[model samples]
Target: MTVRFFNFTDGQNVKLTAERGGYSVIEYQSDMSVNPYEAQLAYFASKMNVRRRQLVCHLDRFPSHCVSMQAGAMQWMSGDVQPKTGIRGAGDFARKLVRGSVTGESAIKPEYEGTGIVTLEPTYKFILLEDVTDWNGGIIIEDGAYLSSDASLTHRAEMISRPSAAIAGGEGLFNLGLYGNGLVALESSVPREELIVADLYDDVIKIDGSLAIAWSPTLQFTVERTTKSLIGSAASGEGLVNVYRGTGRIMFAPVATGHVSSASTGA
Candidate 1:
């Protein structure tokens, strides 16, 4: 069948809008009647420079592909769509549980299939659509970056090779890894335009903090002192820093994300 969006707005109190991909973003316009306090807050927020929340919906047509999403992320599904846990047996469940524990992700993600539309629960964080193939077939993402992905892709948790990396880098012990070819959705602190990408050729890149959102799984991550000598490290005024070495690519959000919290936007 045909899909159409009517009277959709982009930016400036957007009520509804669709991107190039099979996804649509929705936002609530400020209205005094709904919640006067919130409306007033939103109005002043505009003045104070706070961003509005936006929600995303995945639209599927007949003979469409399946999508796997974070647990409890589905807001609603319509038409011939079906949901599955993608779990085969007890062994799979146990493995997923371990992965979830280490990666700090949901234990079980639901897969949606068939010819229908599925909308995810909205969040204040920015939504990013990326093709896994663009990252040389594999990508390791920071914890909680995952939102959804085409079912054809494989998901797992990858552990840091060195314990010191986990403890000193401030990036956690394990990260969510995605493989294969498919479209993936991510919840990012910053929008796509603000993101920076670095491609390495048997080289190294270092960051002062946990700013890299995702990186090629082929790269090695570790924590290192800014200078080789202790006196140099002290004089530099910077201590241990996260470093990515080897030939691969990395995507980073230069801005800090500590203050951002997840909040839902209705479909």
Candidate 2:
């Protein structure tokens, strides 16, 4: 297979470069990553647009950039909003407010109250996107799957209420697959190298940590505890397992340094 990179623009203020191959790689300047999407929503928005769900995905580790460069990328993100509906707020701005007791966060709240909707919150410190909560489409949570929808649809309600952990608590959990159209939130452990696609045939794949971010609703999952006989998982540490089988695309972190924030205790 031969691969070559080329730059082309349709003469808009926007220009992009794409690499060609069996499949084309088109990356907007990481700077304009959020803009093109907003333009698409704007051009296609409708009253029933409220029924069109938007599934937002964020990479836990944002693309690397230097001081000044990072600021430029964030500025591009700031202008990406073009919601014809609800009130919108900045994630960082909302975070500062959520962290602080500032009463002003409500000042920048979304412009409307019902139906047409757009809101902002952080899936992590890096990713932020507006999801059309009023839509009826079931959401596929890849990351920030914790965010919820206020739309009439019931599918995303699972994610809106719980994160990946919800699956364990009798709350039907899996990589959110939408049967109907509506907005939903998804959490993906690995976003850069993995994708969540659905296949008619069901297959199950499991991994170390909760790498199976999202999958179709048809897959069945079970938890298993490992005995001390299993190598490092038993001797050096503990082996906990989550087995998933069925058909669907699972997004897994290529590298599994699974850990929670290890804060130092003043021992």
Candidate 3:
């Protein structure tokens, strides 16, 4: 089967932003305003330096392979495509339900198979096409990062070992973990150009805020005082900090990034 996109070219309204083994990131440009009131606000939004482009991903499937994505993420599909819930049995459904409850992720991720092209919904946030095999077959991501992945990969919920760390680190108690081989799509608050990656080798890295978006599951994560002594910690103007110890890699946004708040403040 052949696939073609109209009004979309290499550097026109749609552009190929990133690609890996299994998926590709397609950036589409469109006017952010739909009505007259929004048009006026869009002018101000542009002046304020707000981003307007939307990010979507295109997945190519083979006859024997499939693609799995977050529930309700499919915008459209073409060619001979069949979709399923990826539930093998009752035990698998139960496990997925529990994992979804703990990690705040969708339990029934939809899977598309057969030779086809699948398009995901558009979003203002940036898209990351990551190869899970690079992280030794497992990676832990922050809440809401999971977008889509090759059907070969599996998802689960991982909990922080220490209650104090989960309470004070600002990373919550549970995170979504992806394992196995294949490419994964992530919706990131910050663009890939602004992400910082650090590879540690039997060392430790500390951050004062919840900036790390994804990290290797092999790394030990915890929260600890900035200094060993309470007096020193107070004098340093820092208290507890999120710490990652061991050999692994971490990717994080250097600055704060998230959805923009509505302009209407209910004045």
Candidate 4:
């Protein structure tokens, strides 16, 4: 297969091509060679925070984002050494979706191209460090976004806001939300095409469990117990679960419900 690249700086785009059957690596300028300990020092030196404009990398495939952690960047950026670990990536902070590809040095990743899949084409953007209102240790989100700590509550609330949607009941409990005009990223066990997205404005929808990845912040989330629980919830299939309310949208993967693993969170 042939590979190609387009370089853009300050809004200018430059196209570059790769040799047939060859691969190209994307990394920070000096990241590839810096010592892990030393890199960490530089990273911390850049204001004691992980984000450094001069140090981060601007790459294709998913807009411009920070490359690996300072140490990982050092290994991958420099000529020949493979990274020993994952970069302290900003994408991981928000459970941002990742494009399927061979990114880690230890394994071969899938290459994604020409497909407008959500995994590779997330609608989330970084909340500039300079403009943060409340710096939550986790993901950075905009005003109208709310992440789902537990699936049931988030999914139901999103449903209350929307109408006629279904999500996997088996995928475990975990999801992130974005609203207003910001970007959101999430990890997906299934590819974008396989995932389902239902938009609702003024209706309610219900499903067996929580598997939604995102919803609008306007929606409200809560927990509810099945009617059986009051008398004999054990007899009924449904149990105590999380709930949602209000209006917005929900994105989820019903196929992998309940089975979602933490290993895939920032994959």
Candidate 5:
């Protein structure tokens, strides 16, 4: 089959920002071709630094590296692609349903197989591709951060060490966990370039807010006071803080990074 794309492949409108583990991040340099009014709006949006970016995953038929994305995330696909709901049976579906309820993720993420190119919906949020192995083969992400992952990974709901602590920390009781050796895509308000990665060995790290985007599952997370005593905490002008103990890696934003609208927000 032969196909030709004008401004697209020519890099006039979009450019490849980064690629990793079969996935690529494409950033739009201009949004001036949608329509007359919309193009003008997009031009202004770009000037305001609100341009859209997209994620694309590639698969090979010879040694296929199938991927599962957030439900309804696929914008387009081509070249002998087949999609499945990732529902093996009724029991499995029930588990996933419960997991979705707790983790704030979709009950059934659709998986795409065979040789093809899968394009996900674009958004203003920054796109990140992380190596799961770098997190010791397991990582837990903040709610609504998940975007896509390799089909070989095991995705599940990871409960907090203390539910009350999670609530006190302004985080969910459970987080979405991705395990195995593969790449996981995430959407974040803070770009990966600005993330602060801290690795601890049998130690502790504390943050005054929920600035962490992802952390190793091996670490124990909790909510604690900045000082040992309530009087001391008040004197220090600090209250509760999110604390992570044990040996693990954490990627967090040094400053407060607000959330961006996501496709799977209400899904």
Candidate 6:
């Protein structure tokens, strides 16, 4: 089969950002013609670092390395690729339904198999690619951050050890968890360049908000008062904070001035 792709070559408006483990992040720069109003808006948007980005998944012929994506994320595909619901039976469907409910993800994420190129819909959010091995074979990502992942990875909804802590921290009851090996793609409002990766070894980290986008599941996360005493906490002008203890790494966007979301919910 012959395939020809345009606007992907050098000097094109659309360019590759990074490619690894069968996933490629393609960025669409603001080079297209637009109306005067749109031109002004795009100009300001570019100044704020907002741009269109897409995720591409390269599937091998082998079924073991197939890819699964959000229900409607696929924009287009080429080659002899085939998509399935990835449902084996009724029991599996029920499990997935519960998982989706808790994780804030699609229940039936479609799985693509065979050799092909699949492109996801473009969005203003940043596309991030991560390898599970880098997070010690498991990762807990914020809700709505998941885009796609190699089929080899196991996905589940992870509940916090302390549900009250989640409520106090302004977090959800559960998070999307990915385990095993392979690459996973995510959607983030903030670019990775602005993110801070904190690697801890039998240590602890605390934050006043839900700033963490992803973290190793090995970390014990909870919400606690800034100070043991409520009066002291009030005096400090800080209340409950998200605390992560044990050995692990967390990817968080620093709280800063300007327009930036405190967490990466892809909102």
Question: Against the true structure, whose lDDT is highest?
Answer: 5
Candidate number with the higher lDDT (3 or 5): 5
Model-by-model lDDT, in order?
0.76, 0.31, 0.76, 0.29, 0.84, 0.82
Tens digit of per-residue lDDT, candidate 3, span 1-267: 576767644655466767666576765444443698788766665465344433233444432368888887787777778899899999999999999988988989989887667777766667787887888899999888888888878787888768675786566788999899777888776778889999999999998878888999989888788999989989999888888899999998888865544211112
Query: Which of the two, 4 or 5, has more lDDT?
Result: 5
Minimal lDDT window, size 10, model 6: 257-266
Better of 1 and 4 by TM-score: 1
* Ten-residue stretch with the least lDDT total in model 3: 258-267
lDDT, residue 263, candidate 5? 39
Residue ranges of candidate 3 with Cα displaced over 4 Å: 1-4, 8-11, 40-64, 259-267
> Which candidate ranks first by TM-score, i.e. highest?
6
Evaluation by TM-score, superior candidate among 3 and 5: 5
Name the runs in model 2 displaced over 4 angstroms: 1-119, 122-144, 148-150, 156-179, 185-202, 226-238, 256-267
Ten-residue stretch with the least lDDT total in model 1: 55-64
**Candidates in order: C-alpha RMSD to true structure:** 3.2, 16.0, 3.9, 17.3, 2.7, 3.0
What TM-score does prediction 6 earn?
0.91
lDDT, candidate 6, 1-267, per-residue tens: 968776563546777898887888887678365688688888877677777777887787224758998988888899878889998799999999999998789999999988888888877777788989899899999888888998988988888878886786678888999999888888777788989999999999998787788999999988888999999999999888888899999998786423534322223
The better candidate by TM-score, 1 or 6, is 6
Which parts of model 5 are misplaced by more than 4 Å? 1-6, 33-48, 61-64, 259-267
Ranking by TM-score: 6, 5, 3, 1, 2, 4
TM-score for each candidate, following the candidate numbering: 0.86, 0.37, 0.86, 0.36, 0.90, 0.91
Candidate 5 to truth, TM: 0.90
